[model samples]
Structure formats: C-alpha cells, structure tokens
Target chain A: MGAIYKRELSGYFNSAIGYVVLAVYYFFSGLFFYLYCFYRDSASLGYVFANMFYIVMFIIPVLTMKTFSEERRQKTDQALLTSPVSLTEIVLGKFLGAFTIYALCCAIFLVYGVVISFFAQPQWSVVLCTLLGMLLLGMAIIAMNIFISSLTESMVVAAVVGMAAGLVIDTMSSFSKLVPIPWVQFVLEKIDFLNYYTNFTYGILSIVDVIFFLSVTGLFLFFTVRVLERRRWS
Target chain B: MIEVKNLTKRYGKITALDNISFTVDTGEVLGFLGPNGAGKSTTMNIITGYISSTSGTVTVDGSEILEEPKKTKQKIGYLPEIPPLYIDMTVRKYLEFMFDLKRVKLPKKEHLDEVMRLVGLEQHGARLIKNLSKGYRQRVGFAQALLGNPPVIILDEPTVGLDPKQIIEIRKLIKSLGKKHTVIFSSHVLSEISAACDRIIIIADGKIIADAKTDELSGVLTDKRQLLLTAEGSAADIQNELKKIPDVQKVKKTGESDGAAQFAIEYKPGADIRRDVFSAMTRLQCPILEMRSGSESLEELYLRLTGSVKGGEA
Candidate 1:
C-alpha cells in the first residue's frame, strides 16, 4: 500500500495534474474569497466554501479523471491486478493519494480564515468545523469519482461522468423540490450535501451532518472496490 | 506442482475454457501450445488467480487457489499476453514497486540488485519503461515475475515480439529457470515447445485436444513415414515387388524416370519395413538405386492438427 501510495502521489506531480488542479481550484476559490469577504466586507467564510463545493463540480474531474481509467486504458492495470497485493490495498492507496492533494488544497483555505482574523473578531472554532466539513465533502466526491474513473477507459468520459454525477449530487434537491409531501421533502433535503454544511458556518458541529457525509463517502468507496472486483469475474 | 480439475470459464455465452484439466509435476516445464484465441491465456489467468473460473478449481501444491488466493498467488508469477508495465516509472522504480506488491520478504536493497542483474536490466534500470524498447520492457515484466522466485511461473507469449537475438536470450533464460521452477508457458510456435518443455499441452477451440510429452506427441500425431524407391524395372514391377514386404501398407508407382521405375512405399502404423524391403530387393536382384523415408517433423504435426499453418515461418 505504501508503494502504491507513493507512486500515485508522484504520478500526480510528474504529470503536472496536482499543480494544475491546485492552480485552477485556488484561482476560482481565491476569487470567490475576495469577492464575498474582502471586497464585500462580509465575515462569512461559508460563502467561500459553498462556492468551492460547487467549483469541485469542475476541477475534481480534472484531479480524479486519470486515477484508474488511464491505468486501464494504458493496460497498466494488468501489472497492478496481477500483483500479490489485495484489492483493498489498491483502492485505499489511490483514495489516500488523491485525498492528500485535496487536503493540501483545503489547508490553503486556512489562509482565508487567518487573514479574516486581522479585522473584526473571527470564530476560529467555526472555521475549524467548516474545514472538517469541507474535508468530508471532498472525501465523498473523491470516492464517487474514483468509481466513475474505474468504469471507463477514456479519460474524457471519466471526467465528464464525474462532473455530471457531482452536478446531480449537488443540485439534486433543487430539482426534487417538486415533491409534495413535507416528509418526502424532509428526506430529500437530507440528500442535499450543501444543506448539511449550513450548520458548520454558524459554529454548530451537527452530528447528523457529519455522519451523513462520512456514510456517503464510505458507501461510494465500497462500491468502487466492488466494481474492480466484479471485472475479474466478468 | 500444479493440478487443474474440470476448470471452466465462460464470458456470457462464449466459453473461453471448457472443463480443461491437466497436471504438471514438480520441476517440470509444461509447454502450453495453441493456435490464436485457443483459450491458453484464459487457462493461465485462472491458474494464476488473476480471474476466477466459472466452475471447477485450480490447486497448486495441494492448496486450492480460490480458497487461499494470497498463498497460491504468492507461489505464482504471471505475464499476460501483453507485458504489464507502468510506462511512467523507471525500470528500477517499477521493480521496487513490484517487489512490494509481491510482498517479497527479502530486503529491497538486496533483491533489487539481484533481479536487475538477473534480467540484464542494470544498465537500463534508470530509464523510464515507456522510453525503453519493446524487448527491454518485456524483460522488466519478466523480472518482476521472478522477483520473489515463485515456484510456479506462467508466461504468455514471452518471445512473441522479440528479435532473434532477444528471443534466444529469453528462451535460454526460461530454460535456466525451468531447472528450478515449475514453468508453464505458452506459445503458438511448435519448435519452441518441442525444444524447451518436458511436456506440451495442445489446446484448440477451448478444449484440451492434445496433451502429451513432447517426443510422444510427435510420435503419436505424426508416426507415418513414406519411402521412395527407384528400381530397374517397370513401375508395376516395383509396386508389386514392394507390396510383398510385411507391414508395407501402400505402394504407388509414378512413372519411369532415368531408366528406372519410381515407386512410393508407405508403412503401417508403428511399423519399420526398411529391413524387409532391403532384404527383398537384394534377393530379387532388381538393383535398388535409392530409398527415402518420410520424416515426422513438429512443423508437419502442428500443421496437421491446426490446419491453418502456412509453412510455419510466422
């Protein structure tokens, strides 16, 4: 697992993918950070994170597109699958490598929080909770996208499918608002990931929201492992 | 040692392998021979635990592969039809990664040096695998398979794309490895198996059509030999004279040539009619000028079995 993790991390830097993702992500994120907080004179970091979550609809595809699709397309999966390592190690290694880059990007959000502290008193605990929420959100997206990547051999298809899936997950309830019953609406609202993050911006670390994010992430990663294993039997 | 029992693999309606079973004893190099798309690769993939068989099982050294995949896989090294390589990595780094993947117990520093030297990749170790030539990439794949010194090595078409020099180099390497390991490798080339393996398994249409020791395969499949004769007589006289010998099945007279009649004599199954013909010709005083027997070659036998062979150059 360590060997695969190191190789995947190095692969990210060598292909310039890690840098490209960070640059594109930060450019848009910094733009929103400046627009909502600095120029507008607002104390809400929630705006920056909310917009960043949407921004992942675009850039996360770029980061995770080649994770497993390129390996299959280039026929490198043969080397990986024939090795003695268990399937779990291969999936976990890739997940951590991708998540590491994501955590690095999310850490940069700390600069926004620190810069805000110079002005009116900022809530450090809320910023910490929001960062944790952001990490969980990114984990869930990475898990979901890795599964999409494993399904196709074309990088373009993987990237496009990832973006589409992210769009549906993020905007799913906006369309599902057509449901009539209040109970149905309540259940559908739970599916809206951004709706859960509303608690973190106000300094309340909602347990249900944390559990929801972690469960979604776990479910997708579990499916990704199954998808790879299914190929062997097929 | 390996034993495959009633192993079958089906991709939907197409059965890639149809209940094929065979066993290789310890220290035996079993040659897997088949025409294109003959399920040889599928069988190897199942045996190596790269894929699951739809039905039946593979046992290596008394351990069932599916039940104890990690332990069974630990003892096997597999190279698929295409050499599996990480083109982005340097040869040295790839080998190091494979060492970890195979869970090699030896220290990396020691095993890396030995494997690099074994596959003759020391000079080219620093180069990215994508930049290396096809033949070198193949060697690195082979080196990774040999990293842990597994008891069983299954190589698919190892020499397919190599130049003549590289082909001889790899065949020699496989031969040397066979001295210690139970090697089950596949090829469409008849001469390669005839030269390298203790036994050969011939597969066709997803079935074990022929399986025998290398010499025995040739002996069973192509035992017939034709004898050519020239004599100072009419064609009918030579034909009549040749048929009187025991075990001589057919005698056909072509035409008179160069003041002698030419006749072709064929022997019955497992028969040696040369001595009988020699004595009969000497007694008749017909003055035999020449005699030739048909040869049973691996090429001829392969052609006879597969039927699509065109002079065997490919």
Candidate 2:
C-alpha cells in the first residue's frame, strides 16, 4: 500500500497533472477570496466556501481521472494485482494519493485565513468548520471519482463520467424542486450534498453531516474494491 | 513446485481453458507450447493470480492461490504477455518500486544491480522506460520477474519481440534460471521450447494434447520409421532393389546427384532395414554413398499434435 501510494503520488508530479491541479485550484481560491472577502471589505470566508461547489466538482475528477484507469490502460494493473499486496491496500493507497493532493490544495485556504488575520479578527471557528467541510466533501468525491475511474480504461471517459456524476450530486436539491411528486422530492432534498455542507459553512459541525460524508466515502471505496475484484473474474 | 488441477476458464460463452491440469517439479523448466490463443496466457494468468479461473485451483508450494494469494504470490514471480511497465519512470526507479511493492528483504541496491546486469540492462538503468526500445522494455520486465528471487517464476512469451541474438540470450537466461527456480515458460515457437525446456506441454484449442520430456516427445511421435539412402546407381535399379526388402513399407525416389540416386524408405516401426538395403545395393554392384535414419522433427510433431496437418501427411 505504501509503495503504490508513493509511486502514484510521484506519478502525479512526474507529469504536469499535479502542478496543474494545484495551480488551477490556487487560482480559483485566490479569485474567490479576492471577490468575496478582500473586495467586499469583509473577513468572512463563508461566501468563498459557498461558491467553491462548482470548482470542487470540476477539480476532483481531474485529480482522480488517472488513478486506476491509467493503470488499466497501460496494463500496469497486472503487476499490482499479482503482487503480494491485498486489493484493499491498493485501493486505499490510490485514494490517499489523490486525497493528499487535494489536501494540499485545501491548505491554501489556511494561508488565505492567515492573510485575513493580519488586518482583522476573522472567525476562526467558522473558518476551521468550512475547511473540515471541504476536506470531507473532497474525501467523498475523490472516492466516488476513483470508483468511476476503475470502471473504464480510458482516462477521458473516466474524467467525463466523473464530472457528470459530481454535477448531478451537487445539484440534486435544485433538480428535486422540479419533481412533481412530494415523496421523491423529499428524498432528494434529504440526500442533497449541499444541504449537509451548509451546516459547516455556518459554524455548525453536525455529527450527522460528518457521518454522511464518511459513509459516502466508505461506500464508494468498497464499491471500487469490488469492481476491481470482479474484473479478475471477468 | 507448482500444481494446477482441473483448471477451467470461460470468458462468457467462450471457454478459454477446458479442464487442463499439469504440475512442475522442483528445479525443472517446463514449457507451454502452443499457437496463438491456445490458453497459454490464460493458464499463466491464473497461476500468477492475475485472473481467476472459472472452476479450478492453482496450488503453488502447497498454498492455494485464491485462498492465500499473498502467501502464494510471494513465492512466485510473473511476467505477463505485456511487460507492465510505467513509462514515466526511469529503469532504476521502476525496479526499486517493484522491489518495495514485492516486499523483498534483500539488500535493494545489490539485488537490483545484479538483476539489471543479468538481463543486460546495467547501462540503461538511468534511462526512462519510454525512451528504451522494445527489447529493452522486455528486458526490464524480465528483470522485474527476477527481483525477489522467488522460487517459482512464470513468464508468458518472454521473447516475443526480441531479435535473434536477444532471443538466444533470453533462452540462455531461462536455462540458467531453471537451476535455482522452477520456471514455467510459454512460447509459440517450436525450436525455442525444444531447446530450453526439459518437459513440454503442448496445448491446442484449450486442451493439453501432449505432455512429455522434450527428447522423448519426438521419439514417441515417430511411430513410423523412415530411412534416407543414396546409392551410386540408376533410379530405377535403386527403386527396384529397395522394393525387395520385405520390411520396407513404401519407397519414393527423392532426387539424384552425381550419378547417385536418393531414395526415402518408410519401414515398420520395429524393423531395422538398413543392413538389408545395404546388402541389396551391394548385390547390385552399387556403392551406398549416404545412409541415415530420420525421425519426425519437433516441428512436425507440433504440427501433427496441434491438428495443423491434414490427410495424415505428418
């Protein structure tokens, strides 16, 4: 697991993907900070966090599109599968490899928080809560996108499908309003990802919301492992 | 060192391997000989635990592959049909990653350097795999299989794209590896198998058609003995004289050179008709120039066993 994680993490930097992901992520975060906090003469990070939904959706797929799909496409999965490592370890190694990059991207927000602190007393509780929210959301999305990557050999197809799935999940509540049936609408609103994330943005670290994100992450990771195991039989 | 029993694999409606079973003893080089799509890769894949068999089990060193994958996989090294290399990594880094992935306990630097030297990749270790040629990529793959020094090594067509010189070098490497490891090598080329393996398993259409010692396979397949004779005489006289031997089943005039007639004589398997033919030629005042016994070559045996020959020509 450690070996795979190290190789995968280095693989991102070996190409331009790691640096590009960081650059794009930092650029968007800086833009949102400038427009929402610096230009507005306010120190609140809530507006910046609230507007990051689309950026997170777009960036997570790019971060994870090559996790397993590249391995499958290059036939490198044979070496990993035939090695002494278990399937669970391989999946976790890949998940954490991408998660580490996303975590680095999130760290930029801490820098922004420090910069805001120089001029005014920013709300530390809200800032930490929103950061936790972003990390948890990233965990679930990375797991889900990694699962999508495992289903196909083409990295392009993985990225496209991953983006599509993220968009639908992120906008489930808005789509729920369009449904005529009350029960279906109620269920979609209940499962809406943004609804759970709203609590963290308002300085409320709800246990139920944390569990929801963790469960989603675990469920998708389990599904990824099963998909890889099923491919052997295939 | 390895045993496969009642192994069967099916890709949907297609049966890739049909109840094929074989075993390799310790310190033996076993070759899987077949044409393309003959379940050679399928069997190796199952043994290496890269894929699962539909209804079968592979036991390596007394541990079942599926039930105890890590334990069994630790005991064997596999080189698949495609060498499973990361193109972005330098040869040294790629091998080091494999070393760590396999969890080998040996001294990493010395072991990797020795493997690189073994496969003639010592000079190319610092180069990226993407810049290396196909033969060099194959050598890197071969070096990976030798990393942990596992007791059992399974290679699927290890010399597919190499030139003739490199092919011979790989063959020699396999021969040397057999001394320390139980090697299961698969190849579609007939001479490659015959030259390297102690025992050969001929698979065709998802079935094991023939399994015998390399030399004994050819011996067992030659049921009808043939003798080639060249005598200093007219073709008609040599043909007529050859017909007088009772054991001679059929005789055909092949060619003539320097007033010598060449005749191919097919005799019953148990009979020794050389002395009779020599005496007949001596009685006819014809000196026998060349005479040699001919058995079915490995190529003919492979062709016949794989059902490529038609009308019993083999």
| CAPRI docking class of candidate 1 | acceptable
Off by over 4 Å in 2: B221-300, B306-308, B312-314
Say which candidate scores most in TM-score: 2
* Candidate 2 residue-wise lDDT, B1-314, digit = tens: 89999999999999999999999999999999988998999999999999999998899999999999999999998999999999999999999999999999999999999999999999998999999999999999999999989999999999999999999999999999999999999998877988899999999879999999988975675676899998997889889889989999999888899999888899988899999998999999999999999766655776777768885476
Q: Cα deviation of A109 in candidate 2 (Å)?
A: 0.4
Off by over 4 Å in 1: A118-121, A181-184, B220-314
| Pairs of residues clashing in candidate 2 | none
Judged by DockQ cut-offs, the docking class of candidate 2 is medium
lDDT of 2 by residue, A1-234 (tens): 999999989999998999999999999999999998989989999999988878889999999999999999999999999999999999999999999999999999899899999989989999999999999999999999999999999999999999999889977988999999999999998888899988999999999999999999999999999999999999
- Predicted structure 2: clash tally: 0
Residue pairs with backbone overlap in model 1: none
Clash totals for all models, in order? 0, 0
Model 2 TM-score is 0.88
